[model samples]
Target: MKITFPHMGNAHIAIKALLAGLKLEVIPPPPITKRTMELGIKHSPEFACLPLKISVGSFIEALEQGADTVLMAGGWGPCRFGYYAQVERDILKDLGYSFRMVVLEAPDFKLSELLNQIKDLSQKVTTLEAVQATRFAWFKLNAVDRLEFCLAKMLPRVINKEEVLAIYRQALQEIDQVTTRPQVNQVTNKSTAEMEQLQQHDQPLLRLGLVGEIYTILEPACNYDIAEQLGRMNVEVYRSVYISDWVNDHLLGGLVKPSNRREILTSSRPYLNYFVGGHGRETVGNAVKLARQHYDGIIQIGPLTCMPEIVAQSVLGEVGEKEGIPVMTMYFDEHAGATGIQTRLEAFVDMLQRRKKSNQVWEQGEQLNAHVPGC
Candidate 1:
């Protein structure tokens, strides 16, 4: 079967590696772009979340490129994500596209079913081969996450930001071409070292935490590359979610230990105690975590009309007030513009800088007064 899947940040890279290793003819969807968004918007429900539209557009693109089957992840929660695969299937069918849809349901509670699905997809491969292929893809996933983490840490500090990004793109390309553990490790290490060599300023900058729906948080096209924009503005950006962490905690049954969900749920208790759907709880939890860690601010991005993120956004205001942390919520759709987002980001950064300086001065004054007299 000629297989294809939706793009989510570096996910396509690992997915390409996995399907190819299974000896399948993999048709990688074209990168999300204006045209893709247009195609999705024209055909999707007016009120559907942004991710659904983009993914539908992506699937259509892949199908046009001769992909006979579409592989998408399924969810089982209050979030609308759980319904994506079936909805996209019907939408594509109505559009008169002839293709098969495969939904890989959340495997945490259905390992055997998930394994069977995998085996069926890898038709001619042995069990051992399938296991090896999965392991290789897992390593690639971890490598991509590590490379991204390094880029986030180095982006704001680099003297020439473009140079760091150039190396990063090249490193991603190199990593994408590899199929073995050692090769993934070699490229990741080389990329990290190259990033480390970029000239950096020693002074600290405003630190911002990003928390939101997973797709919007990770996909640049979806969020207009907000993290890079923040980095360019001399702000340090930290995301609450990563592909590897999500896969490990949810799909792998917490094999890595110290469950991300546990930590998030515990921290979110003061604001939201139960799962409201999507990453709403996690967003609140992460915001609380970042607040306690003394981050300058937090930005929450999600698709317009997304229930979970909306719930999180409502609670975040109270959290921000209580914790004395600034919070900004951004909703994206086809109508969202980069220029507008940049303007807001600039204003937020300016506010944080002013607050930081004010606090510093106030502390200094208090110290001086204490040393001068008992009063």
Candidate 2:
């Protein structure tokens, strides 16, 4: 059977590896572009979120490339992501496309059920083969995330950003092609070393924490490469989510690795005490975490009309005021323009820098006052 899945950042690389290991033909959708966005917007309901529209467009592209089956991740939450598969299936069927849809729900502490879903996907594959494939794919997932972390660190520091980007791209390509742990490690180590060696500016860097929907945070196209843009402006960007972390927490039941969900939940207290679905709680929690860490500012990004993020955004003002951290929220749709995003980002960064300078001046004044003799 041939399989295809929606493109979400670097997720397709690990997924392709997994399906290929199971001896299934994989048809990866073309990289997302303006045409893809247009296709999705044309077909999807106007009220649907950006992820839904983009994913629908991805499926249409894949189906046209001879993919007979589509694989989609499922969840159980107030987030509309749980309903995406059914909605897309109906949309595709209306478009007169013939294909099967497989929705693999998050394990939700049910490993056996998740295994059964895998078994259904590859009936002929033995238990041993399935285990091996999953292991290797997991390695690839971690490798990609680690390399990306390295890229994020180097982008703002390096004297030549493009060179670092080139190294990062080559590393991703290598990781995508390798099928073994050692090979993945070799690429990651080599690329990381290369980035580490690049000369960096001596200027102090402002750091920003990025929090919001997983798709908007991870998919550079959707967010217009916000992290990289900030880096180019001499600001460091740290994200609150990673695909590897999500997979471990949801798909593998945290057997391979544990996410910081416990800590995030604890930090989210007072500001947001309960899960509002998607990454809402995580957003508020991570923002609080970053504030405690002394990050210069926080940016919350998500698709337009996203309920969970909207809920999170509502609470962020209080978070910013209480924590003494400036926060900005940017919502995206097919109509989102790069110029507007860049303009707002520049303004936010400028405000943060000015605030930091003012705080420093006030602290210096307090120190001088403490040294003065009272009359």
Best by lDDT: 2
Per-residue lDDT tens digits of candidate 1, residues 5-40?
A: 999999889889888878889999998988899999
Model 1 reaches what TM-score against the true structure? 0.97
Q: The CA-based lDDT of model 2 is what?
A: 0.91
Residues 1-375 of candidate 2: C-alpha lDDT, one tens digit per residue: 789999889988898898888888999889999888889999999999989999999999989889999999888789999899999999999999999999987676666667778877988798778877777888888888998899889999999999999999988988988878888899999999999999999988899999999999999878888999999999999999998988877677766786788899899999999889999999999999999999999999999999999999999999999999999999999888889998999999999999989999999999999999999
List, in order, the clash count of every candidate structure. Answer: 0, 0
Q: Estimate each model's TM-score.
A: 0.97, 0.97
